[model samples]
Target: MNNLIDELTPEEIAAGDVAITSELVPWHFPMMNDNVRNDAYEKALKAALKNGGTVLDIGSGSGLLSMMAARHGASHITTCDFVEMVAEKAKIITARNGFADKIQVINKLSTTLVPGTDFPERADILVTEIFDNGLLGEHALVAIEHARKHLLKPNAQLIPCGARVYAMCIESSEIYKNHRVETISGFDLSAFNQFSSYEYSGYHIEKSEHKALSKIASIFEFDFLKDTKDESVEITFEVTESGLCHAVVYWYELQLDKDTIISTAPYLPQLSCWKQAVQLLPKPMNLTKGETLKLVAHHDNEAIWFNRL
Candidate 1:
């Protein structure tokens, strides 16, 4: 047997070729290990495939979702991933799992796929899990929009029909330190703060020492079945506790189906593979209880950000 890892030079390994087989690996295992996420998706797939129909899976990492659809009696499944390595691996995985004949793996982006060329015809169901920590960071909106127009049949069922995003102000020195640098070892290292990420950063809110300064409020909602565009929305939140507001923490409720929902909210009893997103403020604001704070949330179909108003 040929060993693939042995073919790579030491330089290639150091260059992240072997260390990171695919950018998908970081989250792939976590997602596969998440019983809550897996169960919810399995349940949704069963419900959608109860009647047996052709399914199109976008961003089908490891072909897990596609296999799930197959297990639930999908007549056939066409799954695609942008990463060539991921697609190749999925093909082998599906074949080994006895789904080689039921599922077809394509190495291309869903947006680039042609209906007849990619598959025999438009699929009757669309299932995908292309969300990032902040929901839109994986270009999910763009992919779903394109797939709905060119790949899926009219009124095709979406695994996750819609999603609602929620946000809340928080006071957390631990989370703030990850983004802002002030002084270290009596030296002013604040100059490096310019490199801090303006976009939302991922963090496990339940694991971090933090306090909720304001009530969590729904800020945005997206329907995967409909066309969407870049949007900006301003939301006002009333402070419930007096403290230094260092960041705005956000999570999403993923509506896998009418009855299946999974959330990344910190209060949830189980920890999900997806972490809550934290948008650090330029500077911490001393908030007073009963005061209202306004912030604008913007999404450009890919990235999301927040700005104080």
Candidate 2:
């Protein structure tokens, strides 16, 4: 996302107008609106439509993927999203791209859709951008589970066919400050850490900010096309540097197709819609270069928190 905080006036930020305007206009973020995401989608969609049939785009935001499917010679495309306003906007977007006849935008959850009524038939291909920071946080498991059981063809091609979350142990006092509330002007308020959220944050950790103590480790993986179950993951990584480790710096890789992959890993050139997400340690731990750190992930609903086993 662009650095709007620096551009906006202090009054706008204080009045919450900056946030309000952000929601009012979602198309401004270059992270999602630019060619980085679209290029990956185009390549994968073209490959999927080599022998095209009906394409189903779950969470088809702004109808871009549907238009891409239409361009790739799909017989028909049914794009669906739960948001009514977004669905309506998709209709207008599809029309502007001159795929109004080939694509239909439906405003309903994927689970509610039925064959022979809402859609003419089960989808031959399932294309969706349903992953979150941890790869499962956006109800992707439930959505894919429902689709495999009811909506998709027996052998449908699932775009972003799989994903894997990679994490590294890091020691960053600067990063910890965001979540930790210590004394401010001589008041002991460390108890506020109990109320601090463990949710993955969209924090941009610069290269200079954090010191990596361990090699990157893959914590979790999901294969969307196959029968899958969500579960917590445990990982152990050998520390490469000695330091005070404070957080798990994490990101995910998207398998758009067999031949294509997109990611938001640190220092990568082509990034996806997601920034890297971090899971802060409850307490800092000192470590050595040769020692290992064991990480146990606790998953509830779709969120994850990493801690010592």
Candidate 3:
């Protein structure tokens, strides 16, 4: 959100501690404060490290996961972050936490990591939390696939073994107004809507008033330990409530292990760091009960989107 940076006062921006481009600072705080997310990763790390092995942590913000691996008795840990500032802070954090001997922080992308040069050898465990609201928007598929092939040992354990994305059609003029520009105050402002995004945008669905028009539909599944490619598929949902479909709201369940799952479902009581993604349709479609809504769900290995068919 550029507004987060734009809202900063001149004095604050001039402060030595402030980073103008550090929009990620706001994100890191919420994620680190999320007990559900932190606890699940800790549990997964403990389970994955039961046999004792080295770990490779991608997107190591603050080096928290890497430190967790070290605490779980991982023999060695190598972590990386593409952001130079975050990587530097992670190194400082690891050292201050007394894990400097066990964890190595790299200021480079995981995609650029080379075995035997970046670290002693391929790691026996891979732990990472690089997902966005849409799951694939941060290129988790590309990074994980590359790690599996070049940075991890054969049969290496994955903290989040996989994930499944789900979507449901919704009717909410309140939400639609954010993306659509129509007649306002007797003036036609609809022409400005040409700049509106057709792609999905993240929102805290719990804070938004909306009515579900269709049952949730499973759209895609990804296995972190396996190689994957860009994919597109047609998914159909049966309308349960007769209403105008304004957008497709989507969320995901992250499978840390077979038994450990963290969900961003709007119905869940706990708030998640990752918000639900909403893809507003170009035009609202009126539907009756029992009608079928077909959507083409596609991911380009980085971002995800849905289109009415």
Model 3 weakest lDDT span, ten residues long: 11-20
By lDDT, the better pick of 1 and 2 is 1
User: Candidate 1 on 60-111: residue-level lDDT in tens?
Assistant: 7889999999999998999999887678778877987999999999999999
Q: How many angstroms is residue 124 displaced in model 3 relative to the true structure, after the best TM-score fit?
A: 0.4
Query: In model 2, what lDDT does residue 108 have?
Result: 97
lDDT of 3: 0.88
What is the lDDT for 42 in model 1?
A: 94
**Poorly placed runs, candidate 2 (over 4 Å):** 1-21, 24-28, 298-301
How accurate locally is residue 309 in candidate 1, as Cα lDDT from 0 to 100?
73
Model 2: per-residue Cα lDDT over 1-309, one tens digit each: 249889755544453444444475353364457587788888999999998889989987778889989999999998898876667767877886799899989999998999889988998988888666566777887788788878888988888788877889888888788788888899989998998877677655664388989999877777877666546777898899999998888887888998888887877665456767887877788999999889786555466678788
What are the RMSDs of all candidates, in order? 3.9, 6.3, 4.8
TM-score of predicted structure 1: 0.92
User: How far does residue 160 in candidate 1 sit from its true spot (Å)?
Assistant: 0.7
